[model samples]
Target: MGPTGTGKSDLGVALARELDGEVVNADSMQFYRGMDIGTAKLAPEERGGVAHHLLDVLEVTEEASVALYQEQARAAIDAVLARGRVPILVGGSGLYVRAALDRLEFPGTDPRARAEIEEDLARRGRSALLAELREVDPESAERVADDRRLVRALEVHRITGRPFTSFMPRREYVRPAVQIGLGGPRGALNERLARRVDRMVERGLPEEVARLDAVGLRRGRTASRALGYRQFLEVLDGLSTVEAAAEATTTATRRLAKRQVTWFSADPRVEWTDFREPPEEQLRRALRRIAEAG
Candidate 1:
């Protein structure tokens, strides 16, 4: 897995075909049912007849929980293995990917505690919560950028009496696995992302957003905030033009790609291939790496 528009979907299909494997999605945004075009979700024909799990399992209004995703993704992988086929986990969501493959533990949440933190957040604001987090968990204070995450960190600290950072996934894999990362130069990726956003708009991202909005897209805490969907939703509200939304989506997607690159690059186990290389060469390198890993 790597950045958006880096051809991870095509690579996953090719690898699944070669290894007789099924694909398990680790992308958080792809979980929603009606978020197709904006998410660049592969159509059924594009999956190359490979069975895919954990896509379109949630409604637009449902909040995505990484803990639930971890359970479902591991079950999908286990089922693939039990059927005598390999499991190819593919997506750009770094934390979800780690939750699927790493030995990460998710602490249970306390709604009462969370509500109290939310109250504090509303009354004292993010800076005050951040200052409090610094006292108990400085690493999470430095890392968390939003109120939702900040509240969750404090809630976890209160309940578990452990730093939120303590729950971070270890580098150790829970099972035998191989990660193949595809990326190219920043300039090329930026151009690709712009082109991709343009294609999405051309393919009717606004209309897609309109349809989901009719079915409560804005009510979704997570799905509504997705890159292109968020921008296009502004178009539905007449707050922005399609052209402006496309531009915003491109900018946001480029930033997301940068973060994805940084996140995946930190993992030593990933064997990266240049997206500028020939598809055949990339596939060969990936297969060789998998063999070496075995």
Candidate 2:
């Protein structure tokens, strides 16, 4: 529950081992199968025998839906609780984390309406769609950063006759839980991200992207847009070199980390730990927080 390259995965595994917990993944990009290297997905052995749910559930060609993810993640958490094990929800995807832990409501989509909006987007371009969204729902237009969200905001407005912001989750938790946020200085995080991208390249991120692209990776609405995967896909298309792609990936990843920090920092409930501290100290602080929450 922190920024990328912040050692969240390792901390989650450590916590799971201490608490007899199973991990329910909240990272959206890690949902796709065969996106291992670029996603920094932990291998089975690396999980320290703690079962992980919701990883490798989607094909490279399929789109990821937060509504569906909410259902799946909640079910996984319930099952883990039923088994008398702690359910550790781990990832840097802020919306997915909120959907799993908070009282967030997802409005039903209208296919016909969606199709119409998609047609409009294709015909009129993103600026036109953004302009229309601003006219109908200025808050949503101000918040939305991309085409997918812009289209969805308009579709939701047309379907529900309400502003998209109305559906945003409140800060109230759906259940008792403690969020452990691991973060460090911005310069340190930037260095970590750069090294991580270089490691991904050394571990065959380009090859992994090539294999997934052969299996329709580019067709995926969500998977194709992931940080390293997107940049490396350009490498596959001869639009960039591996070295250049790695550099671009590092930059994009740093930007994503910044956004994640901003999103999570806005929530007052999170108990943050400095990654500059020793790992055992971080774990001790997290365990103490969880105990206090109980």
Candidate 3:
């Protein structure tokens, strides 16, 4: 779970091919139908015959939650494991990853905290709620840099009367897995992101956004919160011009990439590598490491 346009899918695809694995979409927006371009969805041919699940499976209008993702992700993981193939969970969505792995022992959510957060969100807007998260759990607030996370954190704290992150059981969750990361100088990553966004727009990203709107998936859902789509939707809603939408999307995407760098930095398990070479090098290393331990 890194950030937008950080080659998570490319890395996952490369690893899946090497390991006889299936790719599970962990990006929240990618689950919705009509969200292909903005979500940077792989084309059928581009998938290189690699199987992918949990992508383009729902209407954009649907309000999908992390709980729903956990259920679907579990089914996909079980199916892949049953087939004797590795289930490579891949995406930039940290919450989705935590939910799927059940790696986080989220303190039970409290109704009272939920009510208060919702009330604040309703009255003063999301900014206020985010401030609340910042005050209570700075680490969590940093990780979850959006209103959705703020709301979830509130619920978690209310239910447990403790920081939601306490459920993570930190040490145990780090075991039983190997993590590989795309590591480069910050300037290099930013350059890569700029090029990636340019390529996305050239590939009819705006048209993809238009199609989502046509399909009625343009409102009131987690899918709608995706980077490009949300900015483009503002264009679709007359809040911004088309050119302005593109610029806004690019800005938000860069911000996401920056945050991803921070989140992965503390993960000692992740071995940083050059993206220039075939990812097989890292995948094989991880597989060997995991296998040797047993």
lDDT of each: 0.93, 0.93, 0.75
Per-residue CA lDDT of model 2 for 1-294, tens digit only, reads 999988888899999999999999999999999999888999999999989999999999999999999999999999999999999999999999999999999998899999999999999899999989989899999999888899899999999999999998999889888999988799999999999999999999999999999999999999999999999888878999999999999999999999999999999989999987888999999999999988
- Tens digits of lDDT, candidate 1, 1-294: 999889888899999999999999988999999899988899999999999999999999999999999999999999999999999999999999999999999999999999999998899888888999999999999899778899999999999999999998798899988999999899998998899898988898889999999999999999999998899888887899999999999999999999999999999888989998988999999999999988
lDDT score for residue 141 of model 3: 78
Clashing pairs in 1: none
Q: Which portions of model 3 miss their true places by more than 4 Å? A: 106-171, 278-294
Q: Tell me the TM-score of model 3.
A: 0.76
Candidate 3 lDDT, tens digit per residue, 1-294? 566665678778877887899999988878877677777888788887799999988887889777677778889988998999988888877677767764655355667767778888999987777777778777787787667777888788766677767765353342255556665676777777777767778888878888877877556467777888888777777888877877787778888877777776766666666555566675666567547656
How far off is residue 257 in model 1, in Å?
Answer: 0.6
Instruction: Give the C-alpha lDDT of model 1.
Output: 0.93
Q: TM-scores, in order shown?
A: 0.89, 0.88, 0.76
RMSD of each: 2.8, 3.4, 5.3
Preferred candidate (TM-score higher): 2 or 3: 2
Give me candidate 1's TM-score against the actual structure. 0.89
